[model samples]
Structure formats: structure tokens, C-alpha cells
Target chain A: DTAVSQTPKYLVTQMGNDKSIKCEQNLGHDTMYWYKQDSKKFLKIMFSYNNKELIINETVPNRFSPKSPDKAHLNLHINSLELGDSAVYFCASSQVGKRQYFGPGTRLTVT
Target chain B: TQLLEQSPQFLSIQEGENLTVYCNSSSVFSSLQWYRQEPGEGPVLLVTVVTGGEVKKLKRLTFQFGDARKDSSLHITAAQPGDTGLYLCAGGDSGGGADGLTFGKGTHLIIQP
Candidate 1:
């Protein structure tokens, strides 16, 4: 069974459109995070949630928002997506003192 | 802003060769981790070092944390074709604000058989 899973393995949308990616973890972890990997392959943390509470918000733009309905789910919503928003998004989950487990990742293409 | 800078952005070597990757940062960290990522997949944790000057070994891979906790290194002995992947180093601070990890850009390693 997949420990962490993300919906829509690939997304292609037009600019100025809003889109959402869903992530769920079955490892019963309390912490979840969203990371963005750009064209240059630089991975950066965008947001983090612990027990359904927002814990970390990086320097990401206000257009990017993350919501956690529970300890097992974290979703990312992008508003008015721009061309620069094209990148791979990964969802990960971890316990307080354990290694983080990641999903397959969703490749977002903002055309 | 806290950042981890990795050296040798790309490395290509023949099978059975040895290599080392370095990750450096100006800021001190409470713990450092090494992860390997295959194409189209998220990174998988290989090891974590919490103490300054700590060294850990996994099979043919050896990881070392700097004495000042500002740098780390991963040495792979006798690398094989299956070991080809992107290596990333992440730093975590003890102060409990975000507990979020700062990751390096990563080193892409290619092993040819």
C-alpha cells in the first residue's frame, strides 16, 4: 500500500486559472508538507501542517494556499496560476521523530 | 534565509567508482539528513546525523556531519548503476518554530555500467 498518495499525477492548466491538488497519507503521521521542485530541480518547502494546524509557511506567494482537513490530508490550492508556476509538487508526511515519507509527486504545467 | 548548498551539481562515473558529495550551510543545524531521489519520485531518506562530528555508515555509503554542524558529506564506495540518482541534504533546527527542513539543490549522480 502507498504510504502517501497524491491525486492527478499530472496537471496541465492555463494561466490565470485556479487549481487544487489533493494529498493523503495512510501512515498515520501527524505532520504533512508541500514542496515545489522547479525546472532547475531545486526543491523548496512551501508549507507544512501538523495535526490539521498550519505550522510553517515559507516565502511562497499569497496565491498559493495549503489546507489540511485532518492529520492525514493536506491539499494545495493555487490561484491565478502563472507561467512560473510550472513545477513538480510533492506531498510528504512524517511523525515527530521519524523520517518523512513522500508521494509520487504531481507535475504541474501552467501553460 | 537558511539554505543548504550542495557541491558538484552533476556527476557521471563508471560502475565501481567511488564518489563523495558535500552539503554546506552558513547556519548551524541540530540535525542533518541525506536523501536520494529517483526521477519522477520523491526523495527517500538515507540517514540523519544529529550530533556535531557524527559519522554514520550504511552498507557502502558513509555520511559525516561537520564539527560545527554547518556541513555534511556523503561518500559512496564502489558505486553501482543502481546507485544513480539525485542526492539531497536537508538541515533541521532544534528551535521549535516550524521544524521544517531546509533542503539543498541536490547533486545528480549518474553511474554507467
Candidate 2:
């Protein structure tokens, strides 16, 4: 079984539209995170949630929001998507003091 | 934000060649991790070093954490085609909070047969 899985591996939308990407983990991890990888292959942390509590919110745009209904799920919702947001978004989870396990990533394209 | 900078953003070598990748940072970290990602797949953890001046070995791969806890290195011996992928180093500060890791820009390694 996949440890971390993300839905809609690819998404294409127009600017000013809203979209959501779903993530689920079967590893029973208590912490989940969202990351964005730009074309230059720079991976940056966006948000982190531990046991459904917000732990870290980086300097991401206000249009980006993360919701974790439970410990196993964390979803990212982007409003008024901009062309600059075109990149690969990855979801990851980890047990306390452990290495993170990442999802396959969702490739988002904004026109 | 904590930043991890990786050297030699891109590397291309023939099979059987040896290479070493470095990850450096200004701030100290409580732990450091190395990951390898193939195409269309998530990153796979190669190892984690938690102590200063620590060295860990996995087969032909050697990982070392700097004495200051602000840097790490990954050395691959006799690389093969299978070793071609993106190598990323991430650092975590346990005292900071339970936040996610900070990753380097990543080194794209290409091992040609």
C-alpha cells in the first residue's frame, strides 16, 4: 500500500479559478505538510499540521489555505490561482522525530 | 526561513564514476536527512544524521554530518545508471517547533552508462 497518496495527479485551470488538492496517508502519521517545487527544483515548505493543529505557516500567499480534518488527511485549496502557481505540489507526513514520506505530487498548471 | 543550499546543482557522470554532493546552511540543525527522488515518484529517504560529526554508510553510499551541525555531505562510490535521480538534503530543528523540514534546491545527478 502507498504510504502517502495524493489525488488528481495533474490539474490544469485558468487564472482566477479555485482548486483543491487532496492528500491522505496510511502510515498513521500525526504530522502532515504541503510543499511546492518550482521549475528550478527548489522545494519549499508551505504549511504544516500536527494532529489537526496548525503548526507552521510559511510566507505563502493568503490565497493558499490548508485544511486537515484529521491526522491522516491534509488538503490544499488555492483561490484565484495565478500563473506563478504552476508547479508540482507534494504532500508529506511523518511521525514525530522521524523522516518524512512524500506523495507522488500534483502537477498544477495555471493558464 | 531556514535555508539549505546544495552545491553542484547539476551533475553528469559516466557509470563507475564517483561523486560527492554537499549541503550547507548558516543556521544549525538538530537533524539532517538525505533523499533520492526518481522521475514521477516522491522522494525516498536515504538516511538521517542527528549528531555532529556523525557518519553513516549505506552500501556504497556514505553520508556525513558536519561537526557544526550546519552542513552535510553525500558521497556515492562507483555510481551506476540506477543512481541517476535528484538528490535533496533537508534539515530539521527540533527545538524550533514541530514544523516540516527545510530542503535544498536539489542536485540533479545524471549517470550515463
Candidate 3:
């Protein structure tokens, strides 16, 4: 069974369009996170949610929004996507004081 | 500036060679983690070191946390093509594992057979 899963493994959209990537974890973890990996292979944290409560917002742009409906699901919605937003987005989950488990990333391309 | 920095942004080595990847930071962390990611995939956790000066080994991979909790290293023994991937080091603050991690620019390794 997949411990962490993400939908839309590849996304290609035009600039100014809106898109959403969904994530689900079956590990029963209480914490979920969204991360953006740029073309330079730098992974940066965007948002974090613990038990459906927002915990960390890492100076991400307002156009990028993360919503966690429950402990097992976290979704990222991007509005007015820009060319600079083209990158791999990853979803991860972890228990308190434990290592994180990541899902297969969603490669987003904005034209 | 990046909170964590990794040395040797890219490395290509012949199989059976040993190599070491380094991760450094000026700020101290409560815990440090190492991950390996392949193309088109997210990072997979390799190990987590919570205490300073702690060292953990997973098969041919050895991970070491700095005595000041500001640096870490991953050493691979007899590296094979299967070990080729992007290696990342992340730091977590005192908020436990629930907080967002500060990641370093990953080291991309290519092992040749």
C-alpha cells in the first residue's frame, strides 16, 4: 500500500490559470506539509498543518494556498499561476518526533 | 539565504567508490534528517539524528550528526548505480516533527556502473 499519495503526477497549465494538487496519506499521520522544489533542486517548505490546524506558513506567496480538510489530506491550490511557479510540488506527512514520509511529487509546468 | 547548505552540488563517481556528502548550517537544530530522492519522485527518508554527535548506519550508508547540531554528513560505502540520486538534508526546530523543515539544496549524485 502507498503510504503517501498525490494526484495529478504531472500538470501543464497556462499562466493566470488556477490549479489544485491533492495529497492523501494512509500512514495515520497527524501532520501534513506542502513543499516546492525549484528547477535548481532546492526544496523549500510552503505550509504545514497538524491535525487540520495550520501550524507553519513559510513566507509563501498569497497566490499559493494550502488546505487540509482532515489529518490525512492536504491540498494545494494555486491561483493565477505564474511562469515562475513551474516546479515540482511535494506532499509529506509525519508523526510527532518522527521522520517524514513523502509522496511522489507533482510536476507542474506553467506556460 | 538558505538556512542549510550542502556541499558538492553534483557528483559523478564510478561504482565501488566511497563518497561523503556534507550539510552545514550556522543555526543549531533540534533534529536533522537525511533523504534520497530519484527523478520524478519525492524524497525518501534515510535517517533521522536527534542528538548531537549521534551516528547511525543503514546498511552501506552511514549518517552522522554534528556535535553542535549545526552540521551533518552522509557517507556511502562502495557506492553502486542504485545509490545514484539527489541527497537532501533538512533541519527541524524545537517544534517537533510537526513543523516545517528547513531544507538544503540537495546534492545530486550519479554513480556509473
Candidate 4:
């Protein structure tokens, strides 16, 4: 079984459109995070949620919103997508003071 | 943001060779972690070092945390072709409201047979 899972492995959309990527973890972890990996392969933290509480906003734009309905799910919704947003978005989970486990990643392409 | 800098962004070596990758930072980290990622996948945790001047080994791979807790190194001995991947190092906790682990740009290692 996959410890961490993400929906829509690939996404392609036009600029100004809105999209959402969903993430789920079966590892029973209390913390989940969203990260963006640019073409240069730099993984930047975007948002983090622990037990459905928003933490670690990373100064992300208002257009980028993350919602965690529960400890096991975290979803990222992007409004007015820009071409610069084209990159791989990853979801990761970890227990307190533990190593993170990542999902397969959602590749987003904005035209 | 705490920044982690990784040296030699890219490296290619033949099988049986040994190499070391460095990850440095200005701010001290409560803990440090190393991960390996392949194309079309997310990073896989290799190890985590929490103490200064700590060293941990996994088979032929050895990880070391700097005495200052601001840097780390990964050394692989007798690298095999299967070891080819993007290696990333992250520092600090991924917890606390609005604070996340700072990651290095990553080193792309290519091992050839």
C-alpha cells in the first residue's frame, strides 16, 4: 500500500484558470505539507498543516490556498494560475520529530 | 528562510567510484535530513541527523552532521548504477506555524556502469 498518495498525477491548464490537487496519507501521520519543485529542482515549502491546523504558510500568495479537512488529507487550490506555476507539486507527511514521507507528486503545467 | 546550499549541482562518475556531496547552511538546524528522488517521483528519506558531529552509516553510504549543526555531508562508497538520482538535503523541523524545513537545490548524481 502506498503510504502517501496524490490525485491527478499530471495537470495541464490555461493561465487564469483554477485548479486543485488532492493529497492523502495512510500512514496515520498528523502533519502534512505541500511543496513545489521548480525546474531547477529546488523544493520549496508552501504550506504545512498539523491535525487540520494551518501552520507554516511560507508567505505563499493568497491565490495559493491549502486546506486540510483532517489529519489524513491536504488539498492545494490555486486560483488564477500563472505560467510560472508550472512545476511539480509534492505532498509529504511526517510524525512529530520524524522524517518526511512524500507522495509521487503532481506535475502541473500552465499554458 | 533558512537556506541550504549543496555543492557540485551535478556529478557523473563510473561505477565503483566513491564521492561526497556537501550541504551547507548559515543558520543552525535543529535537525538535518537527506533524501533521494527519482524522476516522476517524490523524495525518499535516506537518513536524519539530529546531533552535532554525529555520523550514521547505511551500508556503503555514510552521513555526517557538522559540528556546528549548520552543515552536513553524504559519502557513498562503491557507487552503483542504481544509486543514480537527485539527492536533496533539508534542515530543521517541518512543524511550527509558518516554519518549514529548508531544502538545498539538490545534487543530481549519475552513476554509469
Candidate 5:
């Protein structure tokens, strides 16, 4: 079974459209995170949730919100997406301070 | 502010050639991780180095952490086309607790046959 998985392997929408990406992990980890990879392939942490509570929220804009309904799931919702938000979003999970497992990723493109 | 700075934004070399990639940082980290990402896929963990001046080998790939824990290196011998991918280095706190890692921009490598 895939340890980590994300929905919408690819997404294309208008600049003002809103979209949501879902992620799930079966690794039974306590901490889950979301990362954004820009056109330059530079990865940056967006948000982190531990046991359904927000642990870290980077300097990302307020339009990007993360919700964790349970320990195994973390979803990202974007409101009025802009062209700058066109990038790959990755979901990762880890147990405590151990190495993290990353999902295949969701590629979002705003036209 | 990217904590880790990786050298050689892009590299393309012939097979069988040897190359090394460097990851540098100004602040110290408790442990550093190296990840390789292929096209259309998420980055996968290649290895993790915890101690200063420590060296670990995985097949032909040699990973070394600097003495100050502020740098790391990845050396590949006899590069093959299958080795083509994006390499990223990340730094994390020494506490080894709940925290996210700071990643480098990543080095895109292409090995031609």
C-alpha cells in the first residue's frame, strides 16, 4: 500500500478559481506537513499539523489554509488562487523526529 | 531565506563520470537529510547524517557531513542515466522533535549515456 497519497495529481484552473487538495497517510504518524515547490524547484514548508492541531504555519499568505480532520489526513484549501500559486504541493508525514515520507504530490497550475 | 545552499543548479554529465554535490549552511543542524526527486514524483529520502565529520555509503553514493554540522556532500561514482534526478538537502533542529526542515533549492542532475 502506498504510505502517502494525494488527490488531483494535476490541476488547471482560472486565476481566481478556488481549489482544494486532499492528502492521506497510512503510516500512522503523528505529524503531517504541506510543502510548496515553486518553478525553481525550491521547496518550502507551508504548514504543519500534529494530532489535528496546527503546529506551524509558515509565512504563506492567508488565502492558503490547511485543515487536519484526523491524524492520518491533512487537506489544503486555497481561496482565489493567483498565478503565483502555480506549483507542486507535497504532503508529508513523520513519526516524531524521524525521517518523513512524502506523497506523490499534486501539481497545481493557475491560468 | 533558504537555510541550505546547494551548488550546481544544474549538471549534465556523461555516464561513468564522477561528480560531487555540495550542501552548505550558515547555522548548525542536528541532522541533515539528502533527498532525490525524479520527474513527476515527490522527493525521496536518500540518506541522513547526524554527526559531524561522519561518512556513510550507499552503494556508489558517498555522503559526508561536515565537522561543524553546517555542511554536507554527496559523491557519486560511475554515474549512470538512472542517477538523473533533483537532489535536495535539508537541515533540521538537533532536538529531533516536532519541527519542519529547511530545504535547499535543489540541484537538477542529468546523466547522459
Candidate 6:
């Protein structure tokens, strides 16, 4: 069974277009996170939710919003996307005091 | 800002060779983790070292944590073509927000057969 999964493995859209990427986890973890990996392969934390509660909110722009409707799901919604937003977004889940399990990742391309 | 620096941004070696990569930081961390990422996939956790001066081995890969908890090393013996991938090191509790891990730039390893 897939422990962590993400939707729309690839997304290509024009600048200023709005998009959303969905993520789900079946590992029954309490903590879910969003990370962005740039072309340089530098992974940075964007957001984190623990048991459906907002826990970590990085210095991402207000255009990027993360919503966790429940402990099992966390989704990212981007508004007015720009060319600089092109990157791979990854979703991960982890139990308290444990290692994280990552999803395959969603590649977002902004033209 | 807390940062982890990975040495040898890119490496390409023949099969059966050995290589070592380093992850260094100026600030201390509560824990450190190593991950391997293949093409079109997210990083997969390989190991986690928490204690100072701790060492762990998985098969032919050996991991070591510095006594100050500010650095770590990954040594792979008998490299194989299947081992080619990007290796990443991350540190936890380096003020990267709550429960966030600060990741290094990563080392790209290409094992040639």
C-alpha cells in the first residue's frame, strides 16, 4: 500500500493561473508537511500540520496557502502563480518523534 | 538562518569504488537525517542519527554524527550502479520553525558501470 500519495504528478499552467495540489497519507501519522524543491535540488520546508492543526508556517509568500481538512489530508493552493513558482512540491507525513514518509512529489511548471 | 553544507556537489565514480560525503553546519541540531532521492521521486529516508558521536551502519553504508551534533558523514563502500542518486542531509530543530527540518543542497552521485 502507498503510505503517502499526491495528485497531479505534473502541472503546467500560465502565469497568474491558480492551481491546487492534493496530498493524502494512509500511515496514520499525526504530522503532515509541505516542502518545495527548486531546480537546484534545494529542498525547503513550506508548511506543516500536526493532527489537523497548523504547526509550522515558513516564510512562503501569501500566495501559497496550505489547507489540512483532516489528519489524513493536506493540500496546497497557489494563487497568482508566477514563473518563479516553478518547482517540485512534496508532501510528507510523520508520527511524533519519527522519520517522515514522502510522496512521489508534484512538479509545477509556470509559464 | 541555519544551513547545512554538503561537500562535493557532484560525484561520478566507477562501480566497486568507495566514496564519502560530508554534511556540515555551524549550529547544533537535535537530530540529523540522511535521505536518498531518485529521479522523479521524493527523497527516501536512509538513516537518522540523534546522539553525538553516534555511528550507524546499514549494509555497506556507514553514517557518523559529529560529537557537537553540527556535522555528519556518509560513507558508502563498494559503490554499485544501482546506488546512483542524490543524497541529502537534513537537520532537525535548527530553528527551522517547529518540527521543520533544514536540508542541505545535496550531493549528486553517479555510479558508472
Q: Specify the highest-DockQ model's number.
A: 5
Between candidates 1 and 5, the one scoring higher on lDDT is 5
Q: In the order shown, what is each candidate's alpha-carbon RMSD? A: 1.3, 1.2, 1.5, 1.6, 1.2, 1.7
Interface RMSD of 5: 1.0
User: iRMSD (Å) of candidate 3?
Assistant: 1.4
lDDT of 4 at B109: 100
lDDT string, candidate 3, A22-97, tens digits: 9999999888889999999999888888865776564788999888777789999999999999999999988865
Write the residue-wise lDDT of candidate 3 on B1-113 in tens digits.
43998988999999999999999999999999999998988998899999999999999999999999999999999999999999999998785657788899999999999
Q: What is the TM-score of each candidate against the true structure?
A: 0.95, 0.97, 0.95, 0.95, 0.97, 0.96
What does candidate 6's lDDT look like per residue over B2-113, in tens digits?
Answer: 9999998999999999999999999998899999999999999999999999999999999999999999999999999999999999998743334767899999999999
Query: In angstroms, what RMSD does candidate 4 have relative to the true structure?
Result: 1.6
Q: For candidate 4, lDDT tens digit of each residue in B30-71? A: 889999999999999899998999999999999999999999
Query: Which pairs clash in model 5?
Result: none
B33-81, model 5: which lDDT tens digit per residue?
9999998899999999999999999999999999999999999999999
> Cα lDDT for residue B9, model 1?
97
- Which of 1 and 3 is the better model by TM-score? 1
List the DockQ of the predictions in order: 0.63, 0.72, 0.80, 0.63, 0.81, 0.59
Q: All models: lDDT?
A: 0.90, 0.92, 0.91, 0.90, 0.92, 0.93
Greater DockQ among 2 and 6 belongs to 2
DockQ measured for candidate 3: 0.80
Q: Is candidate 5 or candidate 6 better by TM-score?
A: 5
The Cα error of candidate 4 at residue A20, in Å, is 0.6
lDDT of 2 by residue, B29-94 (tens): 999999998877788899999999999999999999999999999999999999999999999867
DockQ leaderboard ranking: 5, 3, 2, 1, 4, 6
How does chain A of every candidate compare to the true chain A by TM-score?
Answer: 0.94, 0.96, 0.95, 0.95, 0.95, 0.95
